[model samples]
Target: MGYLYIFGTILFTVYGQLILKWRIEKYGSLPPLVKDKILFLLQLLVDPLILSGFLSAFVASIFWMGAMTKFDISYAYPFMSLSFVLVFILSVFLFQEPVTLYKVIGLSFIVVGIMITSQSV
Candidate 1:
């Protein structure tokens, strides 16, 4: 059940990020940071999709806090790295992004590291 909370954290985090990216892509590029940055940020806040993304992130934090009560941070934090693996695979499919050899190798290392860390617990 603790693991479930961790996975929920990962899932919502990924969903929030992807939704933000999708909304940004669809809405056009952001104004330059130096050019009316505050207004640009305000505009982003009112966007429904971006608001949903923020909500997802908020929910992820809630799940993460719940997970923290169930296990040591050392035991749980490494599992968060699984989000990178998931996001990478998902980005390729959802965004038509290219998958490269190095990406595969790097993701494999993440999996290996998680396995090694799990052994200590």
Candidate 2:
């Protein structure tokens, strides 16, 4: 059950990121960093998809808090990296993004590191 919470945290985090990326891309480029940044952020606030992504991030935090109650941060924090691996795979499938060899190698390392760290618990 504790592990499940960790997985929920990862999934929600990844989903939030992916949705934000997709919606932002659909909306086109943001204003320059030095100009009207507050207005740019305000635009995102009114976007339904971006708003949902923010909600997902909130849920992910809740799941993260629940996981922390059950496991040490060392054990749980490594699992958060799984969201990177998940988002990479999902982007390739959903957005027809390229999957490079380096990405594959890096993702494998992340998985291996998580596995090795989990053994300490």
| Per-residue accuracy of model 2 over 1-121 as CA lDDT, tens digit each | 9988998899889999999989888867777875677787788889998999999999999999999999999879998999989999999998899999999999999999989998954
lDDT for 43 (candidate 1): 82
The sequence of per-residue lDDT tens digits that candidate 1 reaches over residues 1-121 is 9988999999999999899888878767667876677787778889999999999999999999999999899989999999899889888999988999999999999999999998854
Q: What TM-score does structure 1 among the candidates reach?
A: 0.91
Segments in model 1 whose C-alpha atoms lie over 4 Å from true places: none
Q: Ten residues in a row with the worst lDDT in model 2?
A: 27-36
Error of 2 at 90 (Å): 0.3
lDDT of each: 0.90, 0.90
TM per candidate comes to 0.91, 0.90
Error of 2 at 43 (Å): 1.4
